[model samples]
Target: MKILITGANGQLGQEVSRLIPDASRPGRNEMDMADPGAVGRTLDEIQPDLIFNCAAMTDVDGCEKDRNSAYMINSVSPSVIAQYCIKTGARVVHFSTDYVFDGTRGMYTEEDAPDPVNYYGLSKILGDFAVIPLSNSLIIRTSGVFGEKMNFPLFVYTSLRDGKEINAIESSYSPVNAANLARASVEVERKGLSGILNIAGDRISRYEMALGIARFFGMDESLVRKGNKIPGGIARRPFDSSLDISRATKLLDWDFHSLESNISRLDVH
Candidate 1:
Protein backbone atom coordinates (compact mmCIF):
# COMPACT_ATOMS: atom_id res chain seq x y z
CA MET A 1 0.00 0.00 0.00
CA LYS A 2 1.28 3.45 -0.87
CA ILE A 3 1.51 5.72 2.19
CA LEU A 4 2.48 9.35 2.72
CA ILE A 5 3.54 10.74 6.10
CA THR A 6 4.01 14.39 6.95
CA GLY A 7 6.46 15.63 9.59
CA ALA A 8 8.87 12.89 8.55
CA ASN A 9 11.51 14.22 10.92
CA GLY A 10 9.43 14.39 14.11
CA GLN A 11 9.39 11.62 16.69
CA LEU A 12 6.06 10.09 15.74
CA GLY A 13 6.65 10.62 12.04
CA GLN A 14 10.02 8.90 12.26
CA GLU A 15 8.48 5.99 14.11
CA VAL A 16 5.77 5.68 11.48
CA SER A 17 8.40 5.78 8.78
CA ARG A 18 10.28 2.98 10.49
CA LEU A 19 7.14 0.84 10.52
CA ILE A 20 5.96 1.53 7.00
CA PRO A 21 6.67 -1.22 4.42
CA ASP A 22 8.91 0.71 2.01
CA ALA A 23 7.36 4.11 2.74
CA SER A 24 7.87 7.41 0.98
CA ARG A 25 8.46 10.35 3.30
CA PRO A 26 8.75 13.79 1.75
CA GLY A 27 10.28 16.30 4.09
CA ARG A 28 9.22 19.93 4.33
CA ASN A 29 11.84 20.76 1.72
CA GLU A 30 10.05 18.58 -0.81
CA MET A 31 6.50 19.34 0.30
CA ASP A 32 5.89 22.23 2.67
CA MET A 33 2.62 21.76 4.51
CA ALA A 34 2.40 25.52 5.01
CA ASP A 35 2.11 25.85 1.24
CA PRO A 36 -1.24 24.46 0.08
CA GLY A 37 -0.10 24.23 -3.54
CA ALA A 38 2.96 22.19 -2.64
CA VAL A 39 0.92 19.87 -0.44
CA GLY A 40 -1.67 19.29 -3.16
CA ARG A 41 0.93 18.66 -5.82
CA THR A 42 2.82 16.23 -3.65
CA LEU A 43 -0.33 14.32 -2.75
CA ASP A 44 -1.27 14.15 -6.40
CA GLU A 45 2.14 12.78 -7.30
CA ILE A 46 2.28 10.18 -4.53
CA GLN A 47 -1.39 9.23 -4.91
CA PRO A 48 -1.08 7.33 -1.71
CA ASP A 49 -3.77 5.10 -0.33
CA LEU A 50 -3.09 6.35 3.19
CA ILE A 51 -1.88 9.73 4.50
CA PHE A 52 -0.62 9.87 8.08
CA ASN A 53 -0.12 13.42 9.42
CA CYS A 54 2.14 13.75 12.45
CA ALA A 55 3.01 17.41 11.89
CA ALA A 56 1.72 20.32 13.97
CA MET A 57 2.69 23.47 15.82
CA THR A 58 2.72 21.92 19.27
CA ASP A 59 4.47 24.54 21.37
CA VAL A 60 1.70 25.78 23.65
CA ASP A 61 3.49 28.96 24.71
CA GLY A 62 4.41 29.71 21.12
CA CYS A 63 0.82 29.14 20.08
CA GLU A 64 -0.37 31.58 22.72
CA LYS A 65 2.04 34.15 21.36
CA ASP A 66 1.13 33.60 17.69
CA ARG A 67 -2.36 32.20 17.26
CA ASN A 68 -2.37 32.91 13.53
CA SER A 69 0.74 30.86 12.87
CA ALA A 70 -0.62 28.08 15.05
CA TYR A 71 -3.88 27.99 13.12
CA MET A 72 -2.03 27.95 9.81
CA ILE A 73 0.02 24.91 10.77
CA ASN A 74 -2.43 22.96 12.94
CA SER A 75 -5.65 23.72 11.10
CA VAL A 76 -5.01 25.05 7.61
CA SER A 77 -2.42 22.44 6.66
CA PRO A 78 -4.50 19.50 7.86
CA SER A 79 -7.59 20.93 6.18
CA VAL A 80 -5.73 21.01 2.87
CA ILE A 81 -4.59 17.41 3.34
CA ALA A 82 -8.13 16.33 4.23
CA GLN A 83 -9.46 17.97 1.09
CA TYR A 84 -6.96 15.98 -0.96
CA CYS A 85 -7.93 12.77 0.82
CA ILE A 86 -11.57 13.47 0.03
CA LYS A 87 -10.81 14.10 -3.61
CA THR A 88 -8.48 11.11 -4.03
CA GLY A 89 -10.33 8.67 -1.75
CA ALA A 90 -7.29 8.21 0.47
CA ARG A 91 -7.56 7.09 4.04
CA VAL A 92 -6.18 9.87 6.28
CA VAL A 93 -4.88 9.18 9.77
CA HIS A 94 -4.34 12.34 11.80
CA PHE A 95 -2.87 12.79 15.29
CA SER A 96 -4.42 15.23 17.74
CA THR A 97 -3.95 16.01 21.43
CA ASP A 98 -5.85 15.71 24.73
CA TYR A 99 -5.63 19.51 24.98
CA VAL A 100 -8.71 19.59 22.75
CA PHE A 101 -10.72 19.12 25.95
CA ASP A 102 -10.66 21.62 28.80
CA GLY A 103 -9.72 18.92 31.40
CA THR A 104 -12.77 19.76 33.51
CA ARG A 105 -13.55 16.05 33.94
CA GLY A 106 -11.52 13.13 35.20
CA MET A 107 -11.52 10.90 32.11
CA TYR A 108 -12.52 12.26 28.74
CA THR A 109 -14.55 9.98 26.43
CA GLU A 110 -14.90 10.07 22.64
CA GLU A 111 -18.39 11.53 23.13
CA ASP A 112 -17.19 14.41 25.26
CA ALA A 113 -17.51 17.96 23.94
CA PRO A 114 -14.19 19.72 23.18
CA ASP A 115 -13.67 23.06 24.89
CA PRO A 116 -9.99 23.81 24.40
CA VAL A 117 -8.34 26.06 26.98
CA ASN A 118 -5.27 27.15 25.00
CA TYR A 119 -4.64 28.37 21.48
CA TYR A 120 -2.75 25.20 20.47
CA GLY A 121 -5.62 23.05 21.66
CA LEU A 122 -8.11 25.28 19.87
CA SER A 123 -6.17 25.02 16.62
CA LYS A 124 -6.03 21.20 16.81
CA ILE A 125 -9.71 21.14 17.66
CA LEU A 126 -10.31 23.08 14.47
CA GLY A 127 -8.37 20.44 12.46
CA ASP A 128 -10.41 17.71 14.11
CA PHE A 129 -13.56 19.39 12.84
CA ALA A 130 -12.03 19.95 9.41
CA VAL A 131 -11.49 16.22 8.72
CA ILE A 132 -14.61 14.81 10.35
CA PRO A 133 -16.62 14.93 7.15
CA LEU A 134 -14.35 12.33 5.55
CA SER A 135 -15.65 8.84 6.28
CA ASN A 136 -12.15 7.42 5.95
CA SER A 137 -10.49 9.84 8.34
CA LEU A 138 -9.20 8.51 11.66
CA ILE A 139 -8.64 11.04 14.46
CA ILE A 140 -6.51 9.84 17.37
CA ARG A 141 -6.38 12.24 20.33
CA THR A 142 -3.42 11.49 22.58
CA SER A 143 -1.50 13.29 25.36
CA GLY A 144 1.85 13.81 27.11
CA VAL A 145 3.92 12.63 24.16
CA PHE A 146 7.58 11.71 24.87
CA GLY A 147 10.14 9.94 22.74
CA GLU A 148 13.34 10.39 20.72
CA LYS A 149 13.82 13.91 19.32
CA MET A 150 10.80 15.10 21.36
CA ASN A 151 10.84 18.20 23.52
CA PHE A 152 9.81 16.37 26.69
CA PRO A 153 12.53 13.80 27.39
CA LEU A 154 15.12 15.67 25.33
CA PHE A 155 14.62 18.79 27.43
CA VAL A 156 14.81 16.74 30.61
CA TYR A 157 17.97 15.01 29.42
CA THR A 158 19.53 18.36 28.54
CA SER A 159 18.77 19.70 32.01
CA LEU A 160 20.21 16.62 33.67
CA ARG A 161 23.26 16.62 31.41
CA ASP A 162 23.83 20.30 32.24
CA GLY A 163 23.55 19.50 35.99
CA LYS A 164 20.65 21.92 36.18
CA GLU A 165 17.61 21.33 38.36
CA ILE A 166 14.67 19.97 36.37
CA ASN A 167 11.23 21.26 37.38
CA ALA A 168 8.27 19.23 36.08
CA ILE A 169 4.62 19.72 36.87
CA GLU A 170 3.47 17.10 39.33
CA SER A 171 -0.25 17.92 39.12
CA SER A 172 -0.83 17.39 35.41
CA TYR A 173 -1.70 13.98 33.97
CA SER A 174 -1.06 11.96 30.74
CA PRO A 175 1.11 8.94 29.88
CA VAL A 176 1.78 8.82 26.17
CA ASN A 177 4.88 8.09 24.11
CA ALA A 178 5.32 9.00 20.45
CA ALA A 179 6.69 5.58 19.47
CA ASN A 180 3.75 3.71 20.95
CA LEU A 181 1.36 6.30 19.57
CA ALA A 182 2.81 5.77 16.09
CA ARG A 183 2.47 2.02 16.40
CA ALA A 184 -1.11 2.36 17.59
CA SER A 185 -1.95 4.61 14.65
CA VAL A 186 -0.59 2.03 12.21
CA GLU A 187 -2.70 -0.71 13.80
CA VAL A 188 -5.86 1.37 13.70
CA GLU A 189 -5.25 2.40 10.09
CA ARG A 190 -4.46 -1.16 9.00
CA LYS A 191 -7.73 -2.28 10.53
CA GLY A 192 -9.53 0.57 8.79
CA LEU A 193 -10.97 2.04 12.00
CA SER A 194 -12.35 5.46 11.25
CA GLY A 195 -13.63 7.88 13.89
CA ILE A 196 -12.46 9.66 17.01
CA LEU A 197 -10.33 7.48 19.30
CA ASN A 198 -8.49 8.40 22.52
CA ILE A 199 -5.04 6.81 22.32
CA ALA A 200 -2.97 7.54 25.47
CA GLY A 201 -0.96 5.89 28.19
CA ASP A 202 -2.67 4.70 31.37
CA ARG A 203 -3.54 7.70 33.51
CA ILE A 204 -0.82 8.72 36.02
CA SER A 205 0.66 11.80 37.70
CA ARG A 206 3.81 13.54 36.50
CA TYR A 207 5.56 12.98 39.87
CA GLU A 208 5.26 9.19 39.63
CA MET A 209 6.23 9.36 35.96
CA ALA A 210 9.38 11.26 36.91
CA LEU A 211 10.39 8.60 39.39
CA GLY A 212 9.92 5.97 36.72
CA ILE A 213 12.07 7.88 34.24
CA ALA A 214 14.72 8.48 36.87
CA ARG A 215 14.79 4.78 37.64
CA PHE A 216 15.15 4.00 33.94
CA PHE A 217 18.10 6.39 33.57
CA GLY A 218 19.56 5.35 36.94
CA MET A 219 19.60 9.03 37.89
CA ASP A 220 18.82 10.63 41.22
CA GLU A 221 15.11 11.24 41.57
CA SER A 222 15.94 14.16 43.85
CA LEU A 223 17.08 16.08 40.81
CA VAL A 224 13.48 16.27 39.62
CA ARG A 225 11.65 19.16 41.26
CA LYS A 226 7.87 19.18 41.50
CA GLY A 227 5.82 22.19 40.40
CA ASN A 228 2.18 23.13 39.81
CA LYS A 229 0.69 24.71 36.69
CA ILE A 230 -1.48 27.19 38.58
CA PRO A 231 1.21 28.76 40.79
CA GLY A 232 3.83 28.35 38.05
CA GLY A 233 4.03 30.46 34.92
CA ILE A 234 2.58 29.70 31.44
CA ALA A 235 -0.85 28.43 30.38
CA ARG A 236 -3.09 26.43 32.68
CA ARG A 237 -2.54 22.73 31.91
CA PRO A 238 -5.30 20.16 32.34
CA PHE A 239 -5.10 18.71 35.82
CA ASP A 240 -6.95 15.55 34.66
CA SER A 241 -6.48 15.04 30.93
CA SER A 242 -6.64 11.25 31.05
CA LEU A 243 -8.50 9.82 28.08
CA ASP A 244 -10.71 6.72 28.25
CA ILE A 245 -9.18 4.15 25.88
CA SER A 246 -11.96 1.60 26.15
CA ARG A 247 -13.13 2.23 22.60
CA ALA A 248 -9.65 1.99 21.13
CA THR A 249 -8.84 -1.16 23.07
CA LYS A 250 -12.07 -2.94 22.24
CA LEU A 251 -12.36 -1.87 18.63
CA LEU A 252 -8.72 -2.07 17.62
CA ASP A 253 -7.99 -4.99 19.94
CA TRP A 254 -5.00 -3.01 21.13
CA ASP A 255 -3.43 -2.33 24.51
CA PHE A 256 -1.42 0.80 25.38
CA HIS A 257 1.39 0.71 27.96
CA SER A 258 2.48 3.14 30.64
CA LEU A 259 5.29 5.63 30.18
CA GLU A 260 7.59 3.43 32.27
CA SER A 261 6.79 0.34 30.23
CA ASN A 262 7.40 2.21 26.98
CA ILE A 263 10.75 3.43 28.30
CA SER A 264 11.69 -0.05 29.42
CA ARG A 265 11.01 -1.40 25.93
CA LEU A 266 13.36 1.13 24.33
CA ASP A 267 16.89 -0.05 23.48
CA VAL A 268 19.47 2.07 25.28
CA HIS A 269 22.39 2.27 22.89
Candidate 2:
Protein backbone atom coordinates (compact mmCIF):
# COMPACT_ATOMS: atom_id res chain seq x y z
CA MET A 1 0.00 0.00 0.00
CA LYS A 2 1.17 3.52 -0.75
CA ILE A 3 1.98 5.40 2.50
CA LEU A 4 3.04 8.96 3.32
CA ILE A 5 4.66 10.10 6.59
CA THR A 6 4.78 13.80 7.51
CA GLY A 7 7.43 15.27 9.83
CA ALA A 8 9.72 12.43 8.81
CA ASN A 9 12.65 14.02 10.69
CA GLY A 10 10.92 14.00 14.08
CA GLN A 11 11.48 11.40 16.81
CA LEU A 12 8.37 9.32 16.18
CA GLY A 13 8.33 10.14 12.49
CA GLN A 14 11.91 8.84 12.08
CA GLU A 15 10.98 5.58 13.83
CA VAL A 16 7.88 5.20 11.68
CA SER A 17 9.95 5.86 8.58
CA ARG A 18 12.45 3.17 9.65
CA LEU A 19 9.58 0.67 10.03
CA ILE A 20 7.95 1.61 6.72
CA PRO A 21 11.03 2.30 4.60
CA ASP A 22 8.99 2.18 1.39
CA ALA A 23 6.68 4.96 2.67
CA SER A 24 7.10 8.47 1.32
CA ARG A 25 8.81 10.50 4.04
CA PRO A 26 8.40 14.24 3.59
CA GLY A 27 10.22 16.95 5.48
CA ARG A 28 9.06 20.54 6.15
CA ASN A 29 10.75 21.81 3.00
CA GLU A 30 8.76 19.37 0.88
CA MET A 31 5.40 20.00 2.62
CA ASP A 32 5.07 22.68 5.28
CA MET A 33 2.28 21.68 7.66
CA ALA A 34 1.80 25.35 8.62
CA ASP A 35 0.32 25.80 5.15
CA PRO A 36 -2.81 23.70 4.72
CA GLY A 37 -2.91 24.39 1.00
CA ALA A 38 0.64 23.12 0.67
CA VAL A 39 -0.23 20.01 2.64
CA GLY A 40 -3.27 19.39 0.45
CA ARG A 41 -1.16 19.83 -2.65
CA THR A 42 1.39 17.31 -1.38
CA LEU A 43 -1.39 14.88 -0.51
CA ASP A 44 -2.85 15.23 -4.00
CA GLU A 45 0.56 14.62 -5.55
CA ILE A 46 1.30 11.51 -3.48
CA GLN A 47 -2.25 10.14 -3.47
CA PRO A 48 -1.15 7.76 -0.72
CA ASP A 49 -3.51 5.01 0.44
CA LEU A 50 -2.55 5.88 4.03
CA ILE A 51 -1.09 8.95 5.77
CA PHE A 52 0.75 8.86 9.10
CA ASN A 53 0.71 12.35 10.63
CA CYS A 54 3.63 12.45 13.07
CA ALA A 55 4.06 16.20 12.73
CA ALA A 56 3.48 18.14 15.96
CA MET A 57 4.84 21.13 17.93
CA THR A 58 5.72 19.12 21.04
CA ASP A 59 7.64 21.72 23.04
CA VAL A 60 5.39 21.97 26.11
CA ASP A 61 6.68 25.28 27.48
CA GLY A 62 7.14 26.58 23.96
CA CYS A 63 3.49 25.86 23.22
CA GLU A 64 2.50 27.87 26.29
CA LYS A 65 4.54 30.80 25.01
CA ASP A 66 3.23 30.51 21.45
CA ARG A 67 -0.31 29.13 21.51
CA ASN A 68 -1.06 30.08 17.93
CA SER A 69 1.76 28.00 16.43
CA ALA A 70 0.84 25.09 18.70
CA TYR A 71 -2.83 25.14 17.74
CA MET A 72 -1.97 25.58 14.07
CA ILE A 73 0.37 22.60 14.00
CA ASN A 74 -1.38 20.43 16.59
CA SER A 75 -5.04 21.13 15.76
CA VAL A 76 -5.52 22.89 12.44
CA SER A 77 -2.96 20.90 10.47
CA PRO A 78 -4.51 17.55 11.42
CA SER A 79 -7.98 18.87 10.72
CA VAL A 80 -6.86 19.91 7.24
CA ILE A 81 -5.30 16.51 6.64
CA ALA A 82 -8.42 14.72 7.88
CA GLN A 83 -10.62 16.81 5.59
CA TYR A 84 -8.45 16.02 2.60
CA CYS A 85 -8.41 12.30 3.47
CA ILE A 86 -12.19 12.33 3.74
CA LYS A 87 -12.46 13.67 0.22
CA THR A 88 -9.82 11.33 -1.22
CA GLY A 89 -10.74 8.07 0.56
CA ALA A 90 -7.27 7.83 2.18
CA ARG A 91 -6.89 6.49 5.73
CA VAL A 92 -5.22 8.51 8.49
CA VAL A 93 -3.14 7.41 11.50
CA HIS A 94 -2.55 10.35 13.83
CA PHE A 95 -0.42 10.24 17.00
CA SER A 96 -1.72 11.97 20.13
CA THR A 97 -0.42 12.38 23.72
CA ASP A 98 -1.43 11.32 27.23
CA TYR A 99 -1.27 15.01 28.18
CA VAL A 100 -4.89 15.18 26.91
CA PHE A 101 -5.90 14.15 30.46
CA ASP A 102 -5.52 16.05 33.70
CA GLY A 103 -2.84 14.61 36.04
CA THR A 104 -5.33 14.08 38.83
CA ARG A 105 -6.15 10.74 37.19
CA GLY A 106 -3.61 8.18 36.02
CA MET A 107 -4.04 5.10 33.87
CA TYR A 108 -6.46 6.91 31.56
CA THR A 109 -8.74 4.80 29.39
CA GLU A 110 -9.82 5.70 25.85
CA GLU A 111 -13.33 6.39 27.21
CA ASP A 112 -12.11 8.86 29.81
CA ALA A 113 -13.15 12.48 29.30
CA PRO A 114 -10.18 14.72 28.53
CA ASP A 115 -9.38 17.74 30.71
CA PRO A 116 -6.06 19.19 29.52
CA VAL A 117 -4.39 21.54 32.00
CA ASN A 118 -1.85 23.07 29.61
CA TYR A 119 -2.10 24.71 26.21
CA TYR A 120 -0.15 21.87 24.58
CA GLY A 121 -2.63 19.29 25.88
CA LEU A 122 -5.54 21.51 24.89
CA SER A 123 -4.17 21.76 21.36
CA LYS A 124 -3.72 17.98 21.14
CA ILE A 125 -7.22 17.39 22.54
CA LEU A 126 -8.62 19.69 19.90
CA GLY A 127 -6.70 17.80 17.23
CA ASP A 128 -8.01 14.49 18.61
CA PHE A 129 -11.63 15.67 18.46
CA ALA A 130 -11.19 16.96 14.93
CA VAL A 131 -9.87 13.62 13.63
CA ILE A 132 -11.87 11.21 15.83
CA PRO A 133 -15.09 11.69 13.88
CA LEU A 134 -13.51 10.66 10.58
CA SER A 135 -14.64 7.19 9.50
CA ASN A 136 -11.14 6.26 8.25
CA SER A 137 -8.85 7.33 11.08
CA LEU A 138 -6.93 5.90 14.04
CA ILE A 139 -5.96 8.29 16.83
CA ILE A 140 -3.30 6.63 19.00
CA ARG A 141 -2.70 8.39 22.32
CA THR A 142 0.78 7.59 23.69
CA SER A 143 2.75 8.84 26.71
CA GLY A 144 6.33 9.90 27.56
CA VAL A 145 7.71 8.71 24.24
CA PHE A 146 11.50 8.11 23.94
CA GLY A 147 13.53 7.44 20.81
CA GLU A 148 17.03 7.88 19.29
CA LYS A 149 16.33 11.60 19.38
CA MET A 150 16.86 13.65 22.53
CA ASN A 151 14.14 12.79 25.09
CA PHE A 152 13.77 12.50 28.86
CA PRO A 153 15.97 9.44 29.27
CA LEU A 154 18.56 10.82 26.89
CA PHE A 155 18.60 14.08 28.82
CA VAL A 156 19.31 12.14 31.99
CA TYR A 157 22.05 10.11 30.31
CA THR A 158 23.77 13.16 28.87
CA SER A 159 23.58 15.11 32.14
CA LEU A 160 25.10 12.26 34.12
CA ARG A 161 27.78 11.76 31.52
CA ASP A 162 28.75 15.42 31.87
CA GLY A 163 28.79 15.03 35.69
CA LYS A 164 25.90 17.43 36.08
CA GLU A 165 23.03 16.85 38.51
CA ILE A 166 19.57 16.18 37.07
CA ASN A 167 16.21 16.82 38.70
CA ALA A 168 13.50 14.37 37.60
CA ILE A 169 9.84 14.70 38.53
CA GLU A 170 8.38 12.11 40.87
CA SER A 171 5.29 12.19 38.64
CA SER A 172 4.31 8.87 37.11
CA TYR A 173 3.72 8.07 33.42
CA SER A 174 3.72 5.20 30.89
CA PRO A 175 6.78 5.90 28.71
CA VAL A 176 6.47 4.30 25.28
CA ASN A 177 9.40 3.67 22.96
CA ALA A 178 8.98 5.34 19.57
CA ALA A 179 10.11 2.19 17.74
CA ASN A 180 7.46 0.08 19.53
CA LEU A 181 4.78 2.69 18.91
CA ALA A 182 5.67 2.78 15.22
CA ARG A 183 5.37 -1.00 14.99
CA ALA A 184 1.98 -0.98 16.72
CA SER A 185 0.69 1.82 14.53
CA VAL A 186 1.44 -0.23 11.42
CA GLU A 187 -0.19 -3.30 12.96
CA VAL A 188 -3.33 -1.32 13.77
CA GLU A 189 -3.59 -0.05 10.20
CA ARG A 190 -2.88 -3.48 8.75
CA LYS A 191 -5.59 -5.00 10.97
CA GLY A 192 -8.07 -2.38 9.67
CA LEU A 193 -8.70 -1.12 13.20
CA SER A 194 -10.29 2.28 13.69
CA GLY A 195 -11.01 4.69 16.57
CA ILE A 196 -8.75 5.61 19.54
CA LEU A 197 -6.10 3.31 21.06
CA ASN A 198 -3.52 3.75 23.89
CA ILE A 199 -0.08 2.37 23.00
CA ALA A 200 2.51 2.99 25.75
CA GLY A 201 5.03 1.38 28.08
CA ASP A 202 4.33 0.13 31.62
CA ARG A 203 3.55 2.83 34.18
CA ILE A 204 6.49 4.22 36.22
CA SER A 205 7.50 7.46 37.88
CA ARG A 206 9.88 9.88 36.17
CA TYR A 207 12.42 9.66 38.97
CA GLU A 208 12.34 5.87 38.88
CA MET A 209 12.73 5.94 35.13
CA ALA A 210 15.81 8.14 35.34
CA LEU A 211 17.25 6.23 38.25
CA GLY A 212 16.76 2.98 36.35
CA ILE A 213 18.72 4.34 33.41
CA ALA A 214 21.55 5.48 35.68
CA ARG A 215 21.64 2.11 37.41
CA PHE A 216 21.56 0.19 34.11
CA PHE A 217 24.49 2.22 32.74
CA GLY A 218 26.39 1.96 36.06
CA MET A 219 26.21 5.71 36.64
CA ASP A 220 25.82 7.52 39.94
CA GLU A 221 22.12 7.29 40.89
CA SER A 222 22.56 10.08 43.43
CA LEU A 223 23.05 12.51 40.56
CA VAL A 224 19.47 11.86 39.55
CA ARG A 225 17.55 13.81 42.20
CA LYS A 226 13.88 13.20 42.92
CA GLY A 227 11.79 16.31 42.46
CA ASN A 228 8.83 16.65 44.85
CA LYS A 229 6.74 19.10 42.81
CA ILE A 230 6.37 19.94 39.16
CA PRO A 231 9.26 22.17 38.14
CA GLY A 232 8.49 25.79 37.35
CA GLY A 233 7.67 26.05 33.66
CA ILE A 234 5.32 27.84 31.29
CA ALA A 235 3.20 24.65 31.03
CA ARG A 236 1.49 22.52 33.65
CA ARG A 237 2.22 18.77 33.52
CA PRO A 238 -0.01 15.85 34.44
CA PHE A 239 1.43 14.07 37.46
CA ASP A 240 -0.06 10.74 36.42
CA SER A 241 -0.93 10.83 32.75
CA SER A 242 -0.19 7.13 32.39
CA LEU A 243 -2.49 5.42 29.92
CA ASP A 244 -4.02 1.96 30.20
CA ILE A 245 -2.99 -0.14 27.17
CA SER A 246 -5.26 -3.12 27.86
CA ARG A 247 -7.19 -2.57 24.64
CA ALA A 248 -4.02 -2.43 22.55
CA THR A 249 -2.64 -5.55 24.22
CA LYS A 250 -5.86 -7.51 23.63
CA LEU A 251 -6.39 -6.31 20.09
CA LEU A 252 -2.81 -6.41 18.84
CA ASP A 253 -1.62 -9.21 21.11
CA TRP A 254 1.53 -7.16 21.63
CA ASP A 255 3.43 -6.62 24.87
CA PHE A 256 4.91 -3.18 25.48
CA HIS A 257 8.44 -2.99 26.92
CA SER A 258 9.14 -1.64 30.39
CA LEU A 259 11.01 1.65 30.90
CA GLU A 260 14.28 -0.12 31.82
CA SER A 261 14.00 -2.60 28.99
CA ASN A 262 13.41 0.12 26.42
CA ILE A 263 16.27 2.23 27.84
CA SER A 264 18.62 -0.71 27.83
CA ARG A 265 17.98 -1.19 24.13
CA LEU A 266 19.04 2.38 23.36
CA ASP A 267 22.48 2.82 21.71
CA VAL A 268 23.09 6.31 23.03
CA HIS A 269 26.62 7.17 24.18
Among all candidates shown, the one with the greatest lDDT: 2
Model 1: residue 240 alpha-carbon error in angstroms: 2.3
- Top candidate when judged by TM-score against the true structure: 2
User: Ten-residue segment with the worst summed lDDT in candidate 1?
Assistant: 260-269
TM-score, one value per model: 0.89, 0.95
lDDT: worst 10-residue window of model 2: 252-261
Task: Write candidate 1's Cα lDDT for 15-50 as tens digits.
Answer: 888888487799888788667678888888889888
| lDDT of every model, 2 decimals | 0.79, 0.88
**Model 2, span 18-131: residue lDDT tens:** 988999987888788777778888888888989999999999999999999898889988988898888988899999999999989799999999999999999999999889
Q: Tell how far residue 63 is off in model 1, in angstroms.
A: 1.7
Q: Report per-prediction Cα RMSD to one decimal.
A: 2.4, 1.5
How far off is model 1, as Cα RMSD? 2.4
